[model samples]
Target: MGQQKTKKIEKEEPIKEEVKKPAEKIEEKKPEVKPAAKPKKAKAPRVRGQKWTAAKEKIGQKDYVIEEAIELAKSTNNAKFDASVEVHINFQLAKKSKEPIRGMVKLPHGTGKKLNVAIADDKLIEEITKTKKTPFDVLLAKTEDLAKLTKIAKILGPKGLMPSEKSGTLTADPKKTLEELNKGKISYKTDQFGILHQILGKISWDDKKLVENYQTMLSV
Candidate 1:
């Protein structure tokens, strides 16, 4: 056995606990939003012609009956050129009435104006293209030709020159229809606002003729 060595004892160190820091307060940010605005309607342009101004002045604020309205419309003829007399009727519709009021009247004396007529047959399409200006006031087309006229609907619709079956302007025999139209066969319809507007006759027409025409329409 070798000589005995003295045994050394080492003490273990004590573990220290880490101190916890208080949690910091943070503020959340929110996004700002704005509401969209509504669009405004544009006002109709005022009439600038002097004669038209005079015509407006002739029209009274109060409503006029059929006879009196015809007289007023005649008096309002201040145009340098011959002006057609027009009657605008406002109706107090019943709350329950949803159907539109529509009818046609053939003036005995005629409207005293010649309507430029256009036959919308395939054979006549070439004739339409040749005209630089829209020379026709009334366009007559058969059911078969209506599809072809669709190409020019945008141009015709705005002018109220588009012939529709609803107006009885779209006929099977366009030639006969054209003759009747030329003889002052007027068609009218009430607008969305429940107002009816139509030409009575030319301002140059005799008062008796105007009255007769008005009475004929009223009877309808």
Candidate 2:
């Protein structure tokens, strides 16, 4: 018998397939935060002028008589122009009192101001509306013109020029009111701060005249 040649088949290894994997997700970086800044320092207060300081030194802590005060005011005045002599009176009224402190004063010598006066008539109202100009400082109205003034109340009211019975600007006789105004009949009232401010006259006026006006205003 011939030797049997058995063919042995080698076992082939299974083919290894290279499987692809999913990519990893990337993370985003956050922004950096900063601390708050400090506040700036405040500026120093203003310093008064040498002239003003010199003048201030003249006034004392003690209350001065009216005459001395007026003289001191005149002496302290550094202005070259003839400045007005102003008066300010503070009132200690009962807070509960509802009455308003207001009245008209006919100064012996007029308040150096030359007020442009106007009559609040139908024609004046039309002219003011047409021109869009309020050339007058004072407005006097008659009973007949009171109705016409309503058309321009928004115009005159805010300017403190509106005519009213309480203000003594509304009257039956316009002529009399004009004369009184020309004669320096000025109105005054306690301000919201409970102080009354008025001008006596120009400093150039005689001390005697200033004193008289001051006395008259004090009397009221």
Candidate 3:
């Protein structure tokens, strides 16, 4: 027996199994949505009081003469205390003359209001600076005393009590001005819009008196 050729049995190597990874899933992005806006509410109508409604009814759509207007004003008045009868006059000025219309009016029957008039003097100035109180409504000054008033202009100017020649508050004779102011002398001037507002009288006055005042104001 020839020595069996030692055929070494060659061992076959085992094959390695490859692990497959699952394909990654792609996520689709969705757009974000917004909430809808709410609708706005409607506003309520203005409500008028019973007295105001009644008064409006009396003042119907019609142009009233001075006499009729005065009667209506008094009738429509509903104030607990006496109310003033006021007149608002609108002026159509020439385009060339836009200068403010100003002057004084002397009503035949004095305005029901009382005016406290004072003549500026050394004593009055001393009293005002010391007390810081303005006791008078209308101030009148003689020409000589006007220079002295500069000291207190800060106080009187704001109050419209400062004396000036244009307003006829500054004069050579204060006695005459006081006399005029005493006899229903009310000063008036147009606003920038050329409208004049004045108190004719109280609602309690008779129709004749109110009408007279209205006519007089119209004349101006």
Predicted model with the maximum TM-score: 2
Tell me the lDDT of model 2 at 101: 77
Steric clash pairs (candidate 3):
none
* Per-residue accuracy of model 1 over 1-220 as CA lDDT, tens digit each: 9999998888888888898999988877776677777778888887598877777777848877667877786676556887888766777567567666775568888887777788887656655555534677777888778888876677778787777887777889888887877787877787767778877788888888888887777765
Q: How do all models score by TM-score?
A: 0.61, 0.76, 0.72
Order candidates by lDDT, high to low: 3, 2, 1
Considering TM-score, which of the candidate structures 1 and 2 is the better prediction for this target?
A: 2
Where is the poorest 10-residue window by lDDT in model 2? 92-101
User: Best-fitting candidate, measured by lDDT?
Assistant: 3
Taken over the whole model, the C-alpha lDDT of each candidate is 0.75, 0.85, 0.87
User: Stretches of candidate 2 above 4 Å error?
Assistant: 1-44, 96-99, 130-132
TM-score of candidate 1 to 2 decimals: 0.61
- Candidate 1 or 2, higher lDDT? 2
Off by over 4 Å in 1: 1-79, 94-100, 123-135, 150-159
How far out, in Å, is residue 91 in model 3? 1.8
lDDT assessment of candidate 2: 0.85
Tell me the tens digit of each residue's lDDT in model 3 across 1-220.
6877677898999988999999999998888777877877888899999999999998989999988898898788889998899999989776667787877888877779898899998999999988879998889999888889998999998887888877788999999989998988888878778889888988899888888888889888
